[model samples]
Target: MNVNGTLINYYFHCKRQCYFHGNRLNLEDNSENVSIGKALHEERNKCNNTEIEIENIKIDKLTKEYLIEVKKSDADVEAAKWQLLYYLKVLKNKGILRKGKLEFIEKNKTKKKILLFELTEENEKELCEITNNIKKLILQDDIPKVLNESKCKKCAYYEYCYI
Candidate 1:
């Protein structure tokens, strides 16, 4: 199975979510927040000069120096960061090297955000470990535990997990 950027993001955000998605129990289509995010992604791609897609991964905008990821919000910035880093690793395996930029179109209450990252030896090693772990997690017979955090209130899987 291919480990796309979404899996990487979900692995960091919520293991149960990652496992559900990896196992093909998709709930994104039933989510209002997901709809908003998709709309934001469509808007972000409207004027981009170049967008590259590989399997399930989509690079929102690419430039000579950067592989860009556009996000609707910064609520899950760490997940977004790792997703972009995984994209960089994918390109590197194909002999293409570029930095990564995470762009949030809509700022959260406290701050505006635009972050840049580069793939390093350390990042590659960690991501490889994450990739393997995710592979194992998805194949397990049982779903991972629900996190039940404040974020769960907004998750698409909230009803499935709680009710």
Candidate 2:
């Protein structure tokens, strides 16, 4: 399966999540968190008709200076960042270079509301390895160990991991 933005985001947020999504065992449709996020995404995309979908990538907005990604919350900044980075990579590969702008529509007691990213050589190198790792991870016979963190409770795959 192609490693899309969701897979990249899940890989950083939770390894098991990435594995489940990569292996095509999706259960996100039942989660309230996913629903809320999708609602936010739809609302944003509705305005200006900024959503651009190409292959497996759906960018929120693409401007001369930035390729914007709108997130419902800043719950997992790293996950969002990597997802945006992957999008940047995709654009770069297509000869369309632009910086990444992450806009969090909701904040969770965090001071950060907006973040910017540029595709550095180091990040690009790491991304290459990350994609390969994800491919191998999903192909494994055994599932990844469930993370017992508090975030697991809010994850869509909570029941699969905990119950």
Candidate 3:
């Protein structure tokens, strides 16, 4: 499988989760958190059809100056940031360049967090390395160990890792 934005996000959040998803374990549908995230995206898209699909990646919102990614939580900003960077690289490859914007909108919170990023030559190089690493990670014979962190509790693959 090609290393997409989700895989990039998972690589930072949890290697094992990335491996499971990359290898098509497909347990996210059973997670409430995943459902809520999908619902949030659907609701926002209904309000304004800013969502766009280009090749293998789907952008939540794309404006003239920014490629915005909407997230339900900022709990894993590193993961989200890398995911957005990967998207930026994809866009840059397609001759579409824009700054990356990550918006964290919680379930009941009125205030959202916004962070902006621009893909530089330095990061783009790092992202290439990350993509290669993910490709190798998922092809391994043995699964990665469970992360055993607090974040694991909310992960969609929690059961697979813990139970």
Candidate 4:
């Protein structure tokens, strides 16, 4: 599987998470997040003017050039941002978009706006390094051990890693 920039950023956030999710591991038990996200996306799709599910990217209110991503948890925020960033990077690389705004809807209510920038050469380089590191870790089949620290209290994979 060719890992894209989105997955690369995810890898940076947590190697074990990236491995479990990227490799299609059957870890998550509930689809509540998926269902909620789909509903929100369907709402955005209702707008006649808005391009709904264009290719791999979904543009909410296309006229406004806004990308809407619904998050069920704060833990998903970072990965969501990286996904938006990857979309922006692809758009810029293909000369389709110069800039855009990222709107993250939290728990079906709160909204936060972020400006997506064109990925700089340095940013790409750093992402590449992270990607390589993640690939190495995954290929080695080494699941990173939990540090049993305070940070684990908030990790989505805390339960899985702790054991």
Candidate 5:
């Protein structure tokens, strides 16, 4: 399965949450937040930029080695970073990126920009391990428990999970 920004975000929040969101449950019926995020993404995608390859995965913006992730709130930072890191890792794996930068756009403004770098061998190993674990969870027949209360509040799956 392809890992996208949302999956990366879910993984950062909680592995079990990622598994639940990705496999055992569906949020399409109860996700105004998700709809808003998608709208924001469509807005951002309107900006034109050159493309660069990172391990057969194209970096979204290539001109300045910048990866822009638009978010509606500051709370989205961690999730955004994880997604960017994964991109960086992909670039490193393909030897396509020496360095990268992250731009977190909030409320139509640049809230934060930081340098992103290639992951080391150990980091790649850890990433593979984590990805495998997530896949295992998804393949299971039973849904994992809700691991934390904070997750419920911010989760797009909140209605399906908590109600």
Candidate 6:
């Protein structure tokens, strides 16, 4: 199975969520928050034509020097960061190289948020290791324990995990 951006993000956010995703138990369709995020992505990218799809990954935008990811919020910056980094790795494997840019449109009340990232030797190595771990975790018969229930309220798999 190909590890897409969603899996990478979910792996960072919640291992249980990642396992559920890898196992094809999708609950995002019943998620209001997920719908809003999808709408935000579609609305924001409608005017921009840089978005592209590669394998199981969807890049929000790509410029000459950067691969940009536009997010509705910065609530989970770490997950977003790793997701973007994973995209960079996929591109690198195809012989392309570019810097990573994360754009959080609704983080601060007024100011727009943007962070830049680059994949280094260390980061690439770590990501590979993480990817392997994720694959193994997802294949296990048991679901991972919830790490934080407070964060579950905003999760797409909230009901699946708690209810």
Best by lDDT: 3
TM-score of each: 0.92, 0.94, 0.97, 0.64, 0.73, 0.94
Instruction: List all candidate RMSDs to the true structure.
Output: 1.9, 1.8, 0.8, 4.1, 3.5, 1.3
Q: Residue 155 CA error for candidate 1 (Å)?
A: 1.0
Candidate 2: list runs displaced more than 4 Å: 107-112
- Model 2 lDDT per residue over 3-73, tens place: 88999999999999999999889999999989988887787677778899977999999999999998877
Model 5, 63: alpha-carbon shift in Å?
3.0
**Residue lDDT tens for model 1, 13-127:** 9999999999999999999989888876676567654667875677887788999887777889989999999999888888889999997767454554789999999999999
| TM-score, predicted candidate 1 vs. hidden true structure | 0.92
lDDT of the structure predicted as candidate 1? 0.88
- Steric clash count of candidate 3: 0
Judged by lDDT against the true structure, how good is candidate 6? 0.89
lDDT of 5 at 123: 65
Candidate 6 or 5, higher lDDT: 6
lDDT by residue (tens digit), candidate 4, 1-163: 4566435645756666677766766444344444555676677667554654544555454344544443445554556566656666656666665444555555556566454544567866665676676667666666665556665555556667775
Candidate 1's clash total is: 0
lDDT of each: 0.88, 0.91, 0.93, 0.57, 0.62, 0.89
Q: Write the per-residue lDDT of candidate 3 for residues 73-152, one digit (tens) a residue.
A: 99999999999999999999999999999999886899999999999999999999999999999999999998789988
Q: Choose 1 or 3, whichever is better by TM-score.
A: 3
The candidate, 2 or 5, that scores higher on lDDT is 2
Model 2: residue 113 alpha-carbon error in angstroms: 0.8
Q: In lDDT terms, how accurate is model 5? A: 0.62
lDDT (tens digit, per residue) of candidate 6 on 1-163: 7788899999988899999999999999989999999887887778776679987789998888999998888889999999999999999988889999998889456877999999999999999998999889878988888777678998888887778
lDDT-based ranking: 3, 2, 6, 1, 5, 4
- The parts of candidate 5 lying over 4 Å away from their true place are 2-5, 49-59, 76-78, 93-95, 108-115
Error (Å) of candidate 5 at residue 2 is: 4.6
lDDT of 3 at 125: 91
Q: Pick by TM-score: which candidate is best?
A: 3
